[model samples]
Structures are given as structure tokens and as C-alpha cells.
Target: MILGLSKHPSDESIVEGILAGGRKEHEALVALYKKFHVSLERFIIHRSTGRDYAKQPEDIIWEAIEAFVVNVKKGSFTLKDATLETYLKSICKNLWFRYISQEASREERQNKYMAEWDKLEDDVSDMLIEKENWENYINLVNKLGKNCKQILDMRLIEGLSMQEISQKLIANGTFENDQTVRNAKSKCLKKIMELITSNHQ
Candidate 1:
């Protein structure tokens, strides 16, 4: 049994302990995980059919628990209408659905990026074919940043999908997640276009 916790702590107490933070917070988070992880895992696995989850059910549940902790601390979660378990499950479901939605849109996003690249290539076909101009263009891309250059190289040169670039960036500890990768890619592409336009001018 965890010290400073009752045999069966009330939901209110658990919430209070989590908000209080420190040791109480730690204990409360452990308690919450112990109480809900299995149920949430089962919930996730049951709904995971035909979905490509980047994380396992256990990882997703733990991620949900961590998000719940942050929400509770930030007053985003209040145990007013729903029990802790119900509220947590809601968070898990929302997170799962959002992840799936992102996965579903990946192909569409990849096509859009490819179309944009194709248009850019058409616009600068003459310049791009010249060796010196191509080198200068690459130099402009390299100025964006290490990660930006890598992302563009993978997406544009290697023709990798955004999801693939996201995984690589995350693995390298360059970006936090796929959404961040998308944002960075968009910005990098825009910057490249501006640079190319200015360079030609």
C-alpha cells in the first residue's frame, strides 16, 4: 500500500492529491494508473481494429494518464459531472480518434506536398536544370536549419511521406511529434519558395 493513501481513497482526495503535487502528486498518479491502466488498455485494444496506432495500448493509456495529470493540474479537468474513470476514458478515446484522423490524412497531405513541389519544379524548371542554380537552391535550403534541410531532403528529394519524416525526426529527437513535423515542413517549403523567387529576381 502507498503511504499517505487510504485503503480506498475517494475520487475527490485523489484529485486533490494530484493537484497538490510533490509526493502526494506522485502517489496519486501511481494510484490512478494502477486503478485505470488495465481498463483503459482493454478499452483501447477493443477499439484498435483497422487502426495503425503509433503507440501500443499500454503506451496510449499511460500517455492518457499523463495528459489527465496535466489537465487536472491545469484545472482543465474537474470531477463535477463525471467520475475520474469516465473522464479519463474520454480523454483516451479523444486521443485515439485524433491520432487515427491524423493517420488517415497523411496520404492526402503527402499528395498535397508533392503537388506543391511539382508546381514549384514547373515554375523553375529552367533554373533547376542548371547545375549552378541547383547548387544555389540547395544552399538556400541548407540555410533553413539542420532539421529543416533534413525534412526537405527526405520529403522532396527522397520522396518520403510526412509520416515517415515525422518518425525519423522523432527518432532523432529533432521534433516532438508529427504535427510539429508538418508545421516545420510547411514553413520550410514556404521559405524555400521565397528564397528561390528572391534569388531569381
Candidate 2:
């Protein structure tokens, strides 16, 4: 029988079943967790810096899902523009920001940085490559917010300038000014960097 974290016996009938947690509903939700929980956990785990925090990514995911269901029940949140999958990803990232301290050890991370650097064959390939270097980076970049992807695509990828990125952000209603776009871009890049380095092996 399935053991550990008790099963939520219902499917993700988010409106009724999840909000109304009887035995039948709860078990179904538990099964949902079993099905996707490990994948969600793996995403978060890849952001940690050590085994200590590696195991905690799932804890964060479960807590976030519970909180999401609660807020939806209370009408404090809605999935107007976001799909269920997108909503879940947001929760995962928010949890990382909220509980980052509990998620990783600094020394373990520093050692990892030393290793990535020590192993780097050349500078050209460190950030770009005809090699295996950019696989992880590309995947991580692919996971960014829509606005981020566009900005990077235009300015960094498509050879547009920061001014053009700002213009695009404004046109897309993501910002009212260039400074806001720049700041947002900086924050997004920082997040990407943090995720990339957090739990490197």
C-alpha cells in the first residue's frame, strides 16, 4: 500500500473535491500527488544546494498546493489567465523565494561554483557552446516567464537593444517605463541565476 504522506482520496476536482476534503476526495488528491508530486519535487530539488535542502523541495510543493486550494476556496485567488500547470509552477517558485533559507547550504554552493569554474574548458563555452554546456541553461531559460522570454529573445537573442526590449515590454503592458522593464529584467535574471546555481552537483 502507498505509505508516508497520507493520500488525499479524490481527484483534483479543484472547485468541489479539493475544497471539500472527505475521504473519497482526499484519496484522489493523494493519488494526484503521487502521480505528479515527484516531478514537481524534482523541479524544486534541482534548485537546492545540497542533500539537506534537496529533500525539502517536495515539502514546499505540497504546502503550496494546499495553500493554493485554500485561497481558491476563499476567493482570494483565481486562475483567470494561468493554466493549472502555470499556477502550480508559480507556487513552486514563490515557495522558493519564501523559504529560500531552509532550502540550501552556502558552503555546498560555493564548492559547486568552484567546481564548475575549475572544470570549464574555455570562456566561449562557459556561456555558449557547440558543446554540452548550454543544455541545462537552455532548459532553464525555457522555463522563464513569458515576458522574460520575449525580452531575452528580442534583446539578447534577436540582437535588439535594451531600449527595444523596454519598448516591447511597454507595448505588451508589462511596464509603463523603460526603468521598470530594466528592473524587472534584472530581477528575473537574478532569479534564473539563483536557480541555476542553487543545487548544482
Candidate 1 has its poorest 10 consecutive residues by lDDT at 122-131
Q: What would the TM-score be for candidate 2 when compared with the true structure?
A: 0.39
Estimate TM-scores for all models. Answer: 0.52, 0.39
Tell me the whole-model lDDT of each prediction, alpha carbons only.
0.79, 0.62
Tens digits of per-residue lDDT for model 2 on 1-201?
Answer: 322233432223443555556763465456656656777777777776655544377678788788777776687765574655567767887887667754346557756854553343123234444435456656766788777667655644576766887887798788999877766766556555565556363
Best by TM-score: 1
How well does model 2 score by local distance difference test?
A: 0.62
Candidate 1 residues 1-201, lDDT tens each?
Answer: 653766677788789888888898888878888777888888877888755667677777877888988888788888886898898888899888777678769878888976886565445444555535767868888789888789878876787877888998999899998878877877777788788878778
Instruction: Enumerate residue pairs that collide in model 1.
Output: none
Q: Which segments of candidate 1 are over 4 A away from where they belong? A: 6-8, 50-52, 108-201
